[model samples]
Target: MSTEKIPQIAFNPKKNKVLGVEIISIENLMSRNQKTDHSPEKAHVLKFNMIVLFTGGESEQLVDFVWHKVSKNTVIYLTRGQVNAFKFNKNLKGYLILFTNKYLEKQLNALPQTTTIRLLTSHLFSPKIEIPKDLFIKKYFHLFYKEFYKANETHIDTSTIHHLFVILFNKLERLKTNQLPQIKNTERFSIFLKFKELLESEYAKNRNADYYAKELHITYKHLNIICKEVVHATAKQFIDDFIILQAKRALINSTDRSSNIAYAMGFEEPTNFIKYFKKRTGYTPNAFKKIHS
Candidate 1:
């Protein structure tokens, strides 16, 4: 595969308007020749709700922060908003399931099991849960992969794909629960999740703790208390971190100049953004891009 051409697709619910889900076969993404360099690069960003499965090949597996030797029948899940990179060889095979968060939302409104999986959002962390090489889960994954191919070939209805996705997700949840004792949602963690949602929607216009506190229907002091307890940072600190993350993502992905990235990230002046970035990341936007690029 031309590692340079990372295949990507966006599932816009409005356009597709399907009742069920979609699945992309990862095997279809691999080049016919199969041997390719494994170095990390900006892989494609997939925007949709989905589960991703991977079977290791000859190349060392390198995905974001996680590294492991290629093994048979290995499976990995990539939910929405998670970015990934990988290297592979001839035997690599897997599937990428794309669905809507609405499917999960209809079942459970709050982000179920997100706290356990939140480390995935960072490029520098990996889960401790391991998939046994010869376990029954592998069989289920194979079944799901077969269904995925059938779905792609129009042999199965979208509803059948949706049902498979639900079953797979439930199994994954069970695996997670077994590996890590379910983290009880403390009042603090609950507030943090709400704060995070509000941050994503209003980060551009509002960065104040009091504003978030008012919107969350909690006192500023109480909000700060929750943030400090769960995130080990004050509310303002979390806001700064969120803004810095957005700045980094825009800078890395866009062809725009540093000044343009700053303005796009809601900074009134490029210089102010530069100053803020330097304070948090110890580098200017241009400098950071150079390092990552």
Candidate 2:
């Protein structure tokens, strides 16, 4: 595969429209894709969060290279920095809601703490959430669709739209609770979130769990405990897994040479990075890239 960088779609809303939120029909998206240079079916990374609600037909979506089965009532969430590609079926019908992190931050600040926490933690797990069949709850999707389309009007009540999103998210949280392990220790979870934030910004420079622990102002043991409680992985294991994930994304998304990718990921030597990747993923960096590519 050539080393061309994957296409990255930034949040581009219409002029005078709210800077963060956009909702479009799947039909419109497909039409737009035909006119664009980038194909939705090809693997590319996103620069914003997206929620796609499939209201008809069935299909598969590639998120971070994992193909997930999706169908009616399946809502797929894609966060920023994740590699994804859409399999657009003629029968597929839904609405795609795109929101910027800045807009999400605004909503979170006004939302209930539980809503904020659930939304934040949702990114850590599976992106697909199967909404149960219920007419009343399903109406929330229509409400959001209706509310968002008003953006073209002279004045749109964004506050009302934001609240509708909060309600929609809370409903999804209820559905998710049925699928996930019970969350324990909010305080520990909070610390884990902080650790994640730091890791995202520093993983290219620091992979040591000890460094993260120190940055978070916690001992290594305490950090490990937090990691275990929240993600069922040791601190070191979590750090390594994150590094491997980033490596895989880079491998598939960039045209850079393996050595350059390794160096950019903070490895002192490309050989050590190759060995480390092989040990964790059972495939050398170039081999994995070839397979994924």
**Which candidate should be chosen as best, given TM-score against the real structure?**
2
TM-score of every model?
0.68, 0.86
- Candidate 1: minimum summed lDDT over ten consecutive residues — where? 119-128
| lDDT tens readout by residue for model 1, 1-293 | 12133334366432235544655556655652245332323454455555556655544443432355545545565555544555655676766566666665654433356434453333212332356664565556667656655544645555655565556666666656554323355666667777888889999887788999999999999988877666567899989977887776666566678898777777899999999999988898888767555
lDDT on C-alpha atoms for all candidate structures: 0.61, 0.82
Q: Show model 2 residue runs off by greater than 4 Å.
A: 14-16, 118-123, 135-137, 150-154, 177-184, 214-219, 291-293
Quick one: RMSD of model 2?
2.9
What residue pairs are clashing in model 1? none
List all candidate RMSDs to the true structure: 6.0, 2.9
Candidate 2 has an lDDT of: 0.82
